[model samples]
Target: MGIKSWLSKPLASWIVQKQKKWSSDPVGTQKNVFDLLIKKAQKTTFGKDHAFDSIQSHADYCRLVPVREYEGFKEYIELVKQGTQDVLWPGIPLYFAKTSGTTSGVKYIPITKDSIGYHINGAKDALLNYVHQTGKSEFLDKKLIFLSGSPIMEKKNGIYIGRLSGIVNHHVPGYLRGNQLPSFETNCVDDWESKLEKIVDETIDQDMSLISGIPPWVQMYFDRIEERTHKKIKDVFPSFSLLVYGGVNFSPYKRKLIESIGKEIDTVETYPASEGFIAFQDIPGQAGLLLLLNSGIFYEFIPVEEYGSANPTRLTIGEVKTDVNYALVMSTNAGLFAYSIGDTVKFVSTAPYRIVVTGRVKHFISAFGEHVIGEEVEQAMKNALLKHPEVSITEFTVAPQVTPEEGLPYHEWLIEFISMPADMDQFAHDLDQEMIQKNIYYKDLIVGNILRPLVITSISAGGFINGMKKMGKLGGQNKAPRLSNDRSFATIILTA
Candidate 1:
């Protein structure tokens, strides 16, 4: 039997059992996972300092281990860099996932054997759930391509360092290597354009069935494939049926992807951070991603408004109510104790605990008291697209035009359009209107004339690409910032 056929039944069975348990007792499963996480790390230095042994309840875990960000954990991370064993977890991490940072230079996230298991299981369950929902396992017979970073790792203080995708690529099991694509050497190409060219050249003729990556990069691949093949992606690869994406809002890229594919296909969204794999689209036609409760990560939710307060109330899985935006805090097997990864989410369902990503804690524009978040911007854009079907935004960023040289203070938008709207003024007006409806603070600012109407700046083709290249973050999971408090990124695009 083929590898997929051999593994299909057992994998499906395991996922069925997991889903049964998950739906039945999410809270109990969460508690068990939390206890397992603490027990596994109890002998470590972080555990000792945090009093993990005495942590018997969620409240105890919260009280003992305060919510921390990367800055707060930097000292311990430095210790790990200096070859300290068991500084955070029971042993040294196998690798450090180097995250691209806009504020900080680079963040080295610990990737232990236990943590890697979480990543692998998350991917497995994502596909297994897809198969369970659709009853379509035929795609498994063809190649599964991940537009990922180079698997070649760099050594930093005796630990391997690379992007999370690249690190995960190295761990792709031997059994599935035959179905994975883009030669390892091609992935190692540092330049974005060069990498794209190589990937297109390598996979243009292959029997690709599944493609997974961040939307923008995957779109780039699709564009390149079309450019080379002179046909739609579906025509080029008849078996191509699955597209898995995350790391950015899919709403903006949805039209572009669908247009490129030339037909509808199965699409899955995932929330995989360097810190941990948090959630994935499980049930077909579900609105939100089902939270991974039994993963080796204990989750806490703090209300976004109270995020920076001296003592914000942190809620557990069972405590969170639907539709409340909360910043996610996680204590994981990788030895991060109550670490806040800065992404915000809102629970949409309580029965099985599903959530939608709202925005980032830091990624917002409120320079003139007009607080606007990633979700608001995305929704507004979606609303604009609905009104003007001709236009589609490929990528965009918004910044406050605080010190206007030519006009009053306003929000500045730098947009890379797949197709321009018929009426630019109306399009911009509709977007602003949607934002006003969604955010009361923004509406107040506009109504009071504290902020001028938002000004839309059309970015020329490849503007985002050029800007990201200038920022030294051209590829490999690096995406353009959607919103910024300042015009640093927008200025670069405007100047370029």
Candidate 2:
């Protein structure tokens, strides 16, 4: 390896050592980190003599700060839009990471230099830990094809700004950055569609060993590659060895993706948001491990059972356990204290703090009072798909809607199928049967006839996910709503 590449390995190794030192001693590490953050916050204008004096003081301050959803940050976002430096933090934020949440309209999350370091280091630690766990160093040498958002940096008042996409584009090592394909200019608004086309065309023949992005977009790229090359992606990119994806559960699309790839590729699931890179797959066979940014933020978990209710118990990293689902809350370096992002996760293990995302706290159908969660729906769908080989779902969504006849509410399914079952009515019946069998709550509701029969709306190939993407609703950490209980979604499904 050349000097730069050789140096990167050592640097990456150092990051791993540093992270292990922090993660292993969660309480002690957080206390020290929190003390330092409190000092910094106190020095800042917004934090000057403001309630918190120490780490515990900071946590207490956060608890009293009144948890704000993404919408609460809109005023700060407007400051960003104006290129003003009057919000939280010292210097002007380096860039804004474009994202949207359930309650938050399109947002531009600020990423300061310090915040960027936390994200980059978290990602580095994840990579190095993967190497340490799997004993595989080949990935470090391979060409990684990250199917990221557009790298275009928008300029405001002579200062370049955008989302994490822009920051990452500008901040990567010069040598590797130089090796990357030409980035799409963010300043040019009209080039967005063309940029995606360019990314597809440039990597069609390359030895792309590692692919990373939202599953839908990654699949879209593969579909584009197939259409352009007139060959299956497996044939075109025969050297593809790993698929690293985040932003949505791959379980629903796993079987189809695996079959399409024609070989088992090492898969890594990441829980990265525009806010920060929260967790990533550490060991080869394990799901994602939560590598908490102990230094950058105070993490809190509200038990899933208490979700949407007032005063759920808050859990620190040291207090979490395996298999219990919790809604994630974070108090970050960039002045967000005790903020709820509304995502839910389940710990796979607590010894090393591994987590598997359960689903969104807000994204569920509850018309029959069954409290159906995203994970439950995904699991039910998986079983249904597995049992009926004749019915291959390309895309689907679930929602609770009130029928016009009696105005009684029920769950509706909008599904796109690659192949229809010979007996359509039996297929629908089996779908309900599998859901009832796998999910007890759903079964109880169905048995009582409180929930209506499974309503299936056939859509075209790649319709649901693609349509969502076209509507500017796709990103790394956001998935098309699997369960939308609102009238807007109901109207769309009915009209479509």
Candidate 3:
């Protein structure tokens, strides 16, 4: 092993030990983060307007500050965009993470001087924890690729603005520069298809070890490699072992991707967003992501059912229970106070606080009385896949078919199949049965004749991919919605 690789294992051990101190006392660590953030922000305009000086506890904070979504919080973000300093955080933000929003056009999420670590070191700690657990540090010497958006950022109002992954791309530590693949020129290509071809060209002959990206995009890379070499990904990069993925559930795409690689590989799941780097899988093959309580963000949970109620219940880390869904809210050093980032999570374990991302708070199918979520639709697919081994898909989505020309309204399944089942009629039956088992309201609707059984609509080859490209949302942190109440996204595919 090289000298740097030899030293990494011990350093990994040290980092994990230090992190354990905070995880062992989750609530106390969060209390410390809360007090520190409040103390630092009291002099800022938001704090003063909300009477932050007199706030002493969660109850006091909740009374003084109402939870806000990005639309509700845009007034403050507008000030930062205008180069206003000390309007939210103590100083001007270091950078703004530019992200697309459905209801609110483009969102500019601030990354303050104090909160950059949550974006940078949080990824490092994830890798170090892997090394500490498996004692494998040799990948540090081989090539690693983070399939991401263009790292080239643009300046606006004297501050940098770009996608979160693109912004974080600029901060990769010096030590990994030699081992990272996909040259900066290749990375800056605006067209995702063209950029992907160049990435395969650059990395095909190198000694690859680590590959990270959303599952769909990773599958695209694997497809390109197979087309050129006529070999599985494992055959092309024999040393490849670790797969790091985030931003969407991997289970829906897992079966097809595993076949594309032609072998099983270790995987790490993460929960990262523009607002914060929330959690990651610390132990390989673990069911839940370990929440980072001691990071510069103080987290809160509102039961998903009570999220939009007039007086929603707010709970700290200690108050959360396992197996119940809750909307994630946090006050970060990044100047966001009681901010709900629109994601809901289920605590799989609370002894040390680990969670699973359930769905977006707004992404649900409820045109009728039945309000079904992302997790259920995903679970239904998982259940159906188990019964029919011949079934595999490129991607799929669910939407309420509220109006039909001939029959009662029903749910619609838009699917792009890789290997179609011999009988799609039976396949749809199995999927509908699974959905009914997971969601009772949908079952009641079907039985009462208010809704009919689901209809599966097939998208032609490369349809979803082309639709994304048409919208200029082809790659890098862009995810297809699992469930949308409206037909806009589904129409993009159905008409394609």
Per-candidate TM equals 0.97, 0.88, 0.99
lDDT scores in order: 0.87, 0.67, 0.90
Q: 1-496 in candidate 2: lDDT tens per residue? A: 4454455666667766776777687777766666666666664444553455443654576555555677766766676567666455565676767766556667667677777877776655666665565555454454566656555667775346655654565555554554454343421233334555777767776766667777766776676776788886678777677787777888777766766677778877777766777888877676666657574776778897886566668777778887788988876776655667788988887666778888888887766667778887787778777777766666678876666467445677778776777777777787777677757887887777777667676777657655665656544334577886565654554454
> Sorted by TM-score, highest first, which candidate order results?
3, 1, 2
- Candidate 2: the clashing residue pairs are 96-162, 96-163, 97-163, 97-164, 152-186
Clashing pairs in 3: none
Tens-digit per-residue lDDT, 301-405, candidate 3: 999889999889999999989989899998999999999999999999877788999999999999987889999999998888888899899999998888789
Candidate 1 to native Cα RMSD, angstroms: 1.6
The clash number for model 3 is: 0
lDDT of 1 by residue, 199-299 (tens): 88888889999999999999889999988888999999998999998899888999989999999988899999999899999876678998998888888
Write the candidate numbers in order of decreasing lDDT.
3, 1, 2
How well does candidate 1 score on lDDT at residue 426? Answer: 92
Best-fitting candidate, scored by lDDT: 3
Quote the positional error of residue 178 for candidate 2 in Å: 4.3
TM for candidate 3 is 0.99
The clash count of every prediction, one per candidate, is: 0, 5, 0
Error of 2 at 474 (Å): 5.6
